[model samples]
Target chain A: MSAPIQLRPDETFILNVGPQHPATHGVLRVKMEMDGEYIVKAETVLGYVHRMHEKMGENRTYAQYLPNLSRLDYLGALGYTHGHVLSIERAAGIEVPERAEYIRAITVELNRVASHLFWFGAFVMDLGGFSPLMYAIQDREHILDILEGVTGSRLTYCYYRFGGLYNDVDDEFIEATKRFIPNMRKSLKKYAALVTGNIIFHKRLEGIAPVSAETCRKYGATGPVARGSGINFDVRKNEPYSVYSDFDFDVPVYQEGDSLARYKVRMDEIEQSLRIIEQGLAKLPAGPIMTEKKPKNIKLPVGDFYQAVETARGSFGIRIVSDGDKNAYRLKLRSPTYSNMHLFDETCEGMLIMDALAFMGSLDLVIPEMDR
Target chain B: MGGYFSDIFYGGKSLLVGLSITFREFFKPTVTVQYPYQTIKMSARFRGHIELLADDTGSPKCVACGMCQRACPSSCISLDSVSVDIEVDGKVKKKKVLSRYDLNFTTCSLCGQCVENCNFGAIDFSKEYNLASTRKEDFHFDLLDRLKRLEEKKA
Candidate 1:
């Protein structure tokens, strides 16, 4: 690494918080200049886990590389899978069947719930609440079990096809999902009762790490992190890809712009996700899952297409510039966490060390996704 | 003096309230699952490793359609077809069959697209997902061997 930038006489001592630090979350290193835990300045250092996936996508055939989408943000693999498949179908001009759209919506929402649970657990852990971490993860395991049963994988599911789904939902799976809804609702209420009204949680979160709407927009923060600051932007609500338009659910937003607001936004989103899943299950169309029209083996028209999906953390956009080849000329993943993390430099300044970690936790910075 | 006394009383009351919440949960049923001994029941939709299944006739469900070979993102599947001679109903017959159908399981992301696309219901993903091997090639499976087992069961 280049020699540390020389600090002036009055400048603070620089502290590195690891690409390997457990608290930094997934191979992220933050360089902070601290005056005894009160940060004077901060910068996020990334690219530790960058695997050059976008370049690899171009060389592989369209069908040959759908699974690569899962590696980007493995926590919300369903969102990545859904986004890539939706974009490819749009690019190829293939129409997905009605049932496939509904299935996609249901599975993605379930994945969102799972992702939120994990975030809740991790965020609480960051605040030194260990029991809630275990409690949240225990609930999340059930969601994973459900996802793993249908997709035949967990964490990195490449289940969505270009125009449709790889597998059809059986009656048994649908019925089981019906059972999961009521149980999940109970879990959500339990979480609310457990954390929402807790004084300690409120004390740690309330009015802390407040990001104004202007600051959020300036930094291009999206997802709950942005929505917490009163920005009404959700790819599902705004863009309405897949069957998101069909489902009726409110996009929970809080204008408080505080850490508590961010936490509440995520909690409310879980409930909203459950609503979407319920609607999808009740009104799911029974028809062909895969489309009759097939995508070409080794071609995409020379054009650029930018597609965005509201992942659990934020809006994840994949920009592909195709020069009519098997591979993309340039593929850029606009990871929300990376941009959300940009605020860290400003937010951490003048905050205690523990507060800096709390601020980072509220951002929900998934380092692998950012590095990717 | 009055304000200080009031503050002390409220702080003590809230501490008791928070401690009560934790204490109540301590008596509640533990959510921890004893893994290995009591494996967490995988849902019907859970995704796991792909396995080739055999029928009563000991024939593999995989018709060598190559849908998986095409769908695979990692190019981990290797399949080749060959013709074989057989006797059926006292008559000589020649049939095309899968010579080689192997998957580099190490490279396989365990995405079920291959299993999802199989039209013959030949490939089934079992919940027996615990497979960690020393050699990379240990993940490979032969379709013919699985098929013969099905045929033997039928007889």
Candidate 2:
């Protein structure tokens, strides 16, 4: 638990939201100074789930550190893994096969959809709607099944290798993904009817916690958090990686900058992700999954390298400083949630406690990712 | 008065729409898998734990090369190899044989590095996922003994 927030006696009192509360998502403690159910001040205390992943990267070999990437954000593990792999690939000058790049794009997009689907359920659950959570998870299960068929693990997938994929995607995976697109579209329609059109849901979210584009810029928030403020910046389009440039998809933006805007951004992103997946499946070419000239022991050149990828939450960047050794001299994981959650201190002030919690939910703070 | 009535009407309509969605889902097939009784079949590619492979002579194919021990990222694998004098083709020769092979499953990340580095195909991920133990030491498995027991079962 964090130290009690300083407040004048009888004027305000301290309230600790979590480090154990389910609504905080993970072990996140928010020390709030409250005045009659209104937050006077708030501070988010992190590092509960810190695994020293960066230190692990320094000690372990480049290839050995790959598994740690998934543990950071288990829901969006592949995106982190992809960013790590891309960084190493760029640093080591490894050429990935075209088919492998296409496969990575498709699987990553599918993973993004799954992550957003989970967030949708969990966010609605945070708002006291349980039925939407069930529906969202039921739809997300199909994604897990398809990803499991190819990647082997349902959640913490260590599927992406440095230069290519761990294994090839069979026809069954492609067929299942193709079937999933239409099914997801139909579900989205139902979600709109069930949750989106519901007046209660709108009243809870609409115009609550309006984060400006300036606030997003100041905090360096990316993904839906930034896009909801109408930033119009997506790493896939702005700084293209893998085969993302080859595909065409819209970067959904909403100008209201409220919790509802963020929700709409994520929901629209699911549709766009589906489009990217469909395009990737259609354009997927047949080639060797792994590069022929893969080095048995991965060693990067003595230089610093950075790679950024658009994850479901936001932009995940990996920076590696290598001294031409097997292990990194310094490895920094630029987690998006950390930056996005930083705005909480300023944003939560003077707001009602329930709305503040709803705002926290909108940020989609994965504690481990922020702590790491 | 009309505006208030329409507001009520629209609110009721939206509430009804949400109710209808839940009602439709209620009658549909249950997605919950009754665990411990009805288990979903794990895929063939599911990674559980590393197991040693045996040869036709009912001996482990691991040549005491220590490749897997070196390749393990988590340092969870440890083995003791002993150099023994063996008679082969009526000639005495020294051969290194695995005396003890232990794996700390508590720390193992199931990264498949050890399996990939093994040239002899001596190790693979077994598809046994229902792992529950009361004591912590139960996770520390002796693969050599497990392999011998597997061989005995095969024989």
Candidate 3:
């Protein structure tokens, strides 16, 4: 047997960064090992907000569970609502009207833009910059105003249906969005001026949380985080759905494996998303937004179906296992934040504690979605 | 030593540029809205809460059509309609009366599906969404609350 080696005292300090810390973003607890201020190891502990949404899905009918989808990403409720509704429509193989698809596309894109704006604000705030949060929120408020006009609620909007929309978009809404595009474009420039090229922001974010392409591919980091690291995978482009095929837009990519690269990628995508919205508005087809095909008692066929959509955080996928009943047998939400955040333990290693918090911010985690 | 100087020079330049922006914004119009005192007006279009309404006759406009109950995806609403015998002009007439109307607001998605499906336009969403209570029982809304108030007025 080899002789026992002596270890020095105070080589590493165990730090509990809490299930309630502001940087952890939710009830997420990360136990970190630190050598002074530098984090040497991190382990994430989840399930603080887990309400067993999957188990609840099994008990509730397909239609009955529709409302629960918005609760997952409660901060950006529309993204969750859109992903679930789109999945149900795909699974049932129902034909939605052209007008319905157009409306759905419009609302979703608006929601995407709103969600990204919020993330942009929050990300900068995490980096100790405050002005951009208020500025970005100002633009985000306009998008909410447009959605509220038709959907009748601000956040956690349950305005989508399986083969159609809950209501029709009014003429005022059309005019409002038309005016909003220019205003939003102008605001983006201001956001760039405020934080994009700032020295402190660049220093804090550049070359930090370096998630390589191989790592992103291995872990399936979708949305901006993967795109920032030179991954050319976008569910909208790869698996085209709704009226997205009809619209013309580019998928923005950044080859830099850093938080700054992720920031730039999200900002560029926001511009591209605005262009998609513009095209959607211009060629929005006129017809009934709801299908005449309302199935009795919310029953669906028994089968396993997978549907993925681009959310603000990443690629949001819903996998439903149905047993030919009014409700689902099993519903699993592949939340983007959940996958994106798993990298936190690996990336936070050998970084300052504050830098780890900044990295968490860059990932743009929504805790309920992660817990769910 | 040369690289250190170059980095310092670039860092100083970057700081100056950022400061210029700060100085410019300082002179610009302040956009902050004092939320409570000087309120930013929320539009009428803002959909906040779901409310049950009554018609001018103080009777619920919901005709027990069950359209709302059917359209609800969450099944948070449980409705029961009963037929009542009424004597009008010495003839017995059957009228539909709402026996039980239960809405679990906690489970409701605020999707406005029930409101949109109502052909009779009986229900609407109120702008009041500050709905928080200590007990789960407090979330349940009874539409007949207004009807009972009218009955009290008649008395």
Query: Which candidate number would show the highest TM-score if scored against the true structure?
Result: 2
Q: What tens-digit string does per-residue lDDT give for candidate 3 at A112-167? A: 88988998988888877787887788889889889888877778787877778877
Instruction: State the lDDT at A169 in candidate 2.
Output: 93
Q: In model 2 chain B, where is the ten-residue run with the lowest total lDDT?
A: B22-31
Superposed by TM-score, candidate 3 places the C-alpha of residue A132 at a distance from the truth, in angstroms, of: 1.6
How much is the lDDT of residue A294 in candidate 2? Answer: 64
**Whole-model Cα lDDT per candidate?**
0.81, 0.91, 0.82
With candidate 1 superimposed using the best TM-score fit, by how many Å does residue B57's alpha carbon deviate from the native? 4.5
lDDT of 1: 0.81
Which segments of candidate 3 are over 4 A away from where they belong? Answer: A1-10, B1-10, B20-45, B65-83, B88-90, B99-107, B116-119, B129-140, B147-155
- Quality class of the docking in candidate 2, CAPRI style: medium
The window of 10 residues in a row where model 1 chain B has the poorest summed lDDT is: B142-151
Worst 10 residues of 3 chain B by lDDT: B143-152
Task: Tell me the spans in candidate 2 whose CA falls farther than 4 Å from its real position.
Answer: A1-10, B1-5, B86-90
| Residue-pair clashes per candidate | 18, 0, 1
